[model samples]
Target: MFTGIVEELGTVEAVEPLADGGRLTISGPVVTADARHGDSIAVNGVCLTVVEVGEGRFTVDVVSETLRRSSLKGVAPGEKVNLERAMALGDRLGGHIVQGHVDGTAVLRATEPDGLTRFEIPERLSRYLVEKGSITVDGVSLTVVEAGDREFSVALIPTTKQLTTLGVRQPGDEVNIEVDVLAKHLERLARPQLDGLARGE
Candidate 1:
């Protein structure tokens, strides 16, 4: 699990193809300071297990399922990525509970800028969003400032823009999206009741 708070902006050092998966060597000095083999780290909201650790880099194996669900499939060396260590017990929930399990990917439809500020929302994942609801985009926690049937917007402060990948996002870019877990649970719980009402039962 994670808090959706980005700890560092790491880079992909290398990528090697494996038979059923692939090995990624990512450079993250802070997250690997005390890291060891078999530790889990959240990369761009995707939980990855550490296979080896060096000076400031670590290796992780990406299975086919993860590749299909995230934007990591075509990731190349030198690409910047968000990094966060798994949430420890008793830690303050700075952001919402992020599973690092991406629900899907969204396409950047547009960016509205003001004062070097911007709001970048996905056209595909807008339905799950609501005003003031929590969202994880590229592993950074943000709130929806506005929403629509096919698009939602988030106001990005300068710090967030500089520290994470959202600062560089452009129209037509793909981003990993993890919807609020609580909202999903509530929807599941209400589904049957709503169905019964529709049936006049």
Candidate 2:
């Protein structure tokens, strides 16, 4: 339900370890202004439910599975994270339809002076990308400029450079990535027919 639009750069205050998961406390003035228990917030592209909210701070739990999958695995006390609340019913979709569900992680390969950044993606994920397609990286939605077998590029304007975590990210850093849901859906829908065609049916 998120738009992949980062509302603010939240700071991780604490991380409490648990048997099955970890509790994260983060401070985000914009997102916590009207936060409530059970509210969903996108933290670095992962949709997490709010366990508590107060004094410009909020808490969320990340299970072991999420830790193993996304770049949020080793988030530290002072790490800056992208934060965005779930979109309201009537709000405009400033970005694409972002579920705040991280599919996997991509390593930042390079960034140009003009903010043209490229990430080295896995072939499994790259298959879903197309020129000008939408992709969410660390919770910020961006359009693909050059789609390759195992890499892609996106232009981040000055605004995005100053607002989101991507601005400060350097080459070699890892980031959570979510491919367009629509593309994944289409592939699934066509899989059966495509399989039949391969069989000469």
Candidate 3:
């Protein structure tokens, strides 16, 4: 698991296509310092296992399923991505519980001068979002400022803008999104009661 806290901004060094997936080599000096084969690294919010490690770089295979579910499908050489290694057992959860599971992708709709950014998400995922709730965007944990039917906004501090991939996001770019796990748990637990109410029982 990851904490949605970006450890470094890595650059895509190469992308090699496979029959069923693709291999990506990324340059992240910090995250690759102690990395090894089979280690998991969160690359732009998608958990990818390390296949090989080299000087200041590591490679991971992206299966078709992961490619379809994340913005990584559009990644290319020269792209910058947020990178975070799996959290240690005793490490601080600086951000939140980020499973490195991208629920879906959201499109960048707008960005304000004051660091407020809005994203257009699928209507189906709107129920999981709420004002002040935590949301992981491209591997960075942020608090929602506003929530709407298909859009939500988050305020980014200067540190976020400077340290993560979010700082350079442009309008129309797609970002991997993971909503709060607690909200999903609550929904699942309440489903029976909600279903009974719907039946007027």
Candidate 4:
């Protein structure tokens, strides 16, 4: 339910380990201004629920599953993270539809600097990328300029360079990626029924 527009770069204040999960306290002025308990906030593309809130900071519990799926498991104090609150019912959809659910992580393979920067995509998420398709990297929505079997590329303009985390990422860093939901649904609908064919009985 996020627009994939990063409101601000938040910093992790603290991290506490639980038995099967962990609690994270992040400080973001813009997103925490009106925050309340149970509110949803997208932290680096992961939609996490606020368990507690105070001046410019909020707490969220990162369960074992989320940790396994995202780079948040490696997050530590002082790390800068992209932050966005859920889009309001009547708010403008500045970016494409973003669920704030990280499907998987992609490694930064390479970067090419032109008028618009192009990032060499990762193999795991390349199949979902296409020319002009929408992909969320580290919580920022971007369009693919070219795609290949192992790597794809996206054009990043100056504005995108200054506002989001993708601007400063290096090769080898991990980025959270959420493919277009419509593509996923279409793929599911088009999948052949192998089980039915195998069981002719």
Candidate 5:
């Protein structure tokens, strides 16, 4: 698991195609300082395993499923990506609990000079979002300012605008989004009751 707090802005060094998936070589000095194979790292909110570590860089294999679910499908060399090491036990949860599991991708709809940004999300994911709820976007945890049927907005601070990939993201860009895990759990736990109510029982 992760805290959605970005530790570094890493660069994609290379991408090698594989039969069933692909391999990515990313240069993230901080995350790889003590990294070893099988470690979990959140790269742009996707929990990818370390395949190998070498000289301030590491390799990860992205399967077809991850590519289909995230914005990493067509990631290229030299692109910047948010990087975070997996949180250790008893560590402070600076941000919300992020599983690094991208529920889906959201599109950057618009942006304002003051960091009030809007994103158009998949309609099905809207139910989990609420005002003030936590959402992970491209590995950065942010609070939802407004929620809509197909869109939502968040207020980004100056530090966020200069530290993560969201800072340089332009309109029309697609980014990974993870709705709060707690919300999903609650919904699952209440589904049976909700179904009974729907039947007027």
Candidate 6:
């Protein structure tokens, strides 16, 4: 698991298309310092395993499923991506629990000068959002300030803007999103109880 704390902003060095998927070569000096084969790295919020590691660069294979669920499908060379290594057992949970599993993608709908950003999410994912809830956008964890039917807003501090890819995002740009996993677990656990209540059991 990851904490959604971006360790570095990496650049996509190359992309190679395959019959079933694609291979990505990314350059992240910090994250690749101790990298090895089979190590997992969160690339723009999608967890990808390292297939090979070289000087300040690592390669990973992106399967078709991951592409369908993330904005990585449209990624190309020269793109900046958020990078984070899996959290160590005793490391501080600086942000929140980020599984690095992109649930879906959200489109940046608006942005304000005062650090407020709004994103248009799918209706199905909206239920998982709450005021002050945690959400990972492009691998950076943020809290929701406003939750709507198909949109949510988050306030970004200057530090966040300067350290991550979010600072350069524009309206209509698609970002990978992962809602709070706790919310999903709670919802699943409550379903059976709700069903019993509905039947007057």
RMSD of each: 2.1, 0.9, 1.0, 2.7, 0.8, 1.0
Model 2 off-target regions past 4 Å? none
lDDT of 3 by residue, 52-137 (tens): 99899999999999998999988999999999999999999999999998999999999877768999999888889999989999
lDDT for every model? 0.86, 0.95, 0.94, 0.85, 0.95, 0.95
For model 5 the local lDDT of residue 62 reads: 95
Candidate 6 lDDT, 1-201, residue by residue in tens? 999999999999999998888999999999999999999999999999999999999999999999999999999999999999999999999999999989999999898777689999999999999999899999999999999999999998888888999999999999999999999999999999999999999
**Clash number for candidate 1:** 0
Tell me how far candidate 2 lies from the true structure as C-alpha RMSD in angstroms: 0.9
Clashing pairs in 2: none
lDDT by residue for model 4 over 71-188, one digit each (tens)? 8999999999999999889999988999988988877777765544444455666777778988888888877777787666777777777888877888788888888988888767
**Candidate 1 vs candidate 3, lDDT winner:** 3
Which of the two, 1 or 2, has more lDDT? 2
Expressed as tens digits, the lDDT of each residue in 1-201 for candidate 2 is: 999889999999999998998999999999999999999999999999999999999999999899888988889999999999999999999999999889999999998776579999999999999999999999999999999999999999889989999889988999999999999999999999999999999
Local error of candidate 2 at 7, Å? 0.6
TM-score of 6: 0.97
Superposition TM-score, candidate 3 onto the true structure: 0.97
Q: How many clashes does the backbone of model 3 have?
A: 0
Q: Lowest-scoring 10 consecutive residues by lDDT in candidate 1?
A: 113-122
